[model samples]
Target: MTTGPRGFRRALNRGIPRRNRTLVALVAFTVVLTAAILVWPTVAPLTGLVVPLLLGSILLSPRQLPWFVVFLMVMLMLAIGRQQTIEVRTVIAIAILYLLCFIVLVTSFRRTRLGVAGVLGESMLVDLRDRIQQQGGIPPLPPVWLVETALRSAGGTPFAGDFVVATRPRHSNRLEIALVDVSGKGEQAGTRALLLSGAFGGLLGALPPEDFLPAANDYLLRQAWAEGFATAVHLSLDIGTGEFEVRTAGHPPAAQLTAGAGRWTVHEA
Candidate 1:
């Protein structure tokens, strides 16, 4: 059966922390070497040997394999040198090959980082959101059910039609929902939208419209470089009172529909 790296990761599952320490060390070493190469290219030839050394160390564990591969690219580039070597055609061919390889490597690393960040970020956000809702001093009588979607939509293109839903407590009850169209799309948009949905869901229970708006504003400002902010609305209706409270935070106005009357209204918050 397969052993080695699999065995090591399994052993790590048995409560040993040293395996994690080793992985961190290897990653840090790779980052340091990459930085050194970029900042001090004069010494690049010497640091270039780190690629093979790192690869040899990979047999010690599986976690650092990607870092070693990256180091290999550094080594190859340094070997090519900046002083120029072959003909223009040969140089062009080599550059194209290197570009293709770099694209593949970077894309793979980015996807991996996204998956890891999703797990850890989701966990931390869940806890922090719960705490904020609890502190907001006026949670909804019943918890709201929320739905989050990746910004990819059904097709493989970026779209801003992301949405969230909050179901009332009873099966026969009406639902309070929020459909937010973020300012951007793709990974960055999806991540920020998810965060905004969670933050709004939690705060809708506890804070007033003004405070909630500013809170979400500050959150998004920290996330993106532009002046963009979410345009969202909070909608809720009382079963007995038949009244609603609608809040907007730079988001689009919400649409309300009545079943038998066939009348629709776009709310302004």
Candidate 2:
């Protein structure tokens, strides 16, 4: 509901998908190994090879850490067996260096990843906010102020299953607004909400008020998704006069607030 530091952290920690991370790790590990092999001849006894290998492993996802560890162990054994003249104390010291390097490199990689992800997520949110503002179809000004909000259960994304679209036709005194709830929830439903918002917003003031519901019904029937039903409330209001017409499709009745009596009344459309 609130966008702050905690929310930014949550978005960053959302992390790249496991499959993509694995692919990136594999590519990075391959490149590091290839480069090490190319330079293996110049580095005698492979005294510091394990450190670079451990650092390379930091590119890998947590699930892939074991594979990298096994590879490192195999390489270490081969290097030790080939260089029998190398001292045991030197081998032990190299192992210690490798361990320290692994710890530091992994910690640094994670922080860097979070930093990059935070920037990426903030950019994505900015883009989404701009698109929603442009395509939301909300009128600049209206006789009545309508407050709309949506809460998503899917990782606090701004998109949701419910949406509102409003428009005031040119050379007309009527204000048309539609509140729609799609069949599903979270990101999946948010997609449908986006599609329907565009379609309904375009059709809202294009036809006479009476034909709006029938056209929307035809559009939905054409979609023909299994168990894909939506509930919508369409309101057409006169700007000068306090008269309005409401149409509902499988939606709950709307409530009216009376300022004179300071009471609320529910009306079924």
Candidate 3:
């Protein structure tokens, strides 16, 4: 009952519409076959070879292959009835060759699709990383270098529910940071995270340090999703004095490390 790669693949296949070039080619091939039947009655048997040839040129799903095979059989029978001395071996050889060609076509199409998807996926990741950087992910504070920092998604996916946005206001001596967790996970939560990141990034340095969290709360309240809720911690720190204030909403307490003691202490702000 679990959805693994195969299940996800099936879901994706169902969701995406594949181009039906084979159907169109089949129509054209049918027209040619009909014309041969009407105009050159003696050549009608040879014209049936074009059906399998046309089918082999395109990729086909398992469900469509049976119907195409039936069509080819019917065409072959009609061709046999119109002509004498039609070699059964020749027909079989042609069918085998067409099957091989169909397999090759399907393999090539799969490889091409996978290659294109990989390229596009990597490009999108690069763009998303650049956007996160532009929004000021893990701000650089002078004389207060971060000891360690890490961000991870729920299940090692590209999209995540948690996000951090940090900034130093213009002409101000304080650093503002917000760690937010959206209601869901994976792509859906990542979408909301991106939206909130944009909104919070804009609100962070623009508003007073004390007003930032309140503004964010108001923004979340105005959103249309009734069931959606988020947890966040907003921190404001003085670069010169090292004085800091932390605010939280439905989030865990902030922790501080005492370098000399080599221990961590939790702060409920």
Q: In angstroms, how far off is 204's CA in candidate 2?
A: 0.8
Name the top lDDT candidate.
3
The TM-score leader among the candidates is 3
Model 2: residues with Cα > 4 Å off, grouped in runs: 1-37, 40-137, 142-155
Q: How good is model 2 by TM-score?
A: 0.54
Worst 10 residues of 2 by lDDT: 111-120
Misplaced by over 4 Å in model 3 are: 1-126, 133-136, 144-147
- TM-score of each predicted structure versus truth: 0.43, 0.54, 0.55
> Is 2 or 3 the stronger prediction by TM-score?
3
Clashing pairs in 3: none
Best-to-worst ranking by lDDT: 3, 2, 1
Q: lDDT for each of the candidates? A: 0.54, 0.66, 0.70
Give the lowest summed-lDDT range of ten residues in model 1: 143-152
Better of 1 and 2 by lDDT: 2
Residues 1-269 of candidate 3: C-alpha lDDT, one tens digit per residue? 64999998787667654545554466557656755764676555554565554554344444454455456556655655665554787577556645654664465456454443333445766787668656655566775555245778878865677888888887898888888888986877876777788899999989998888889999998997766779999889888888999999889999988989999988897
Give the clash count for each candidate: 3, 0, 0
- Error (Å) of candidate 2 at residue 98 is 20
> How far in Å is the alpha carbon of 211 misplaced in model 3?
0.8
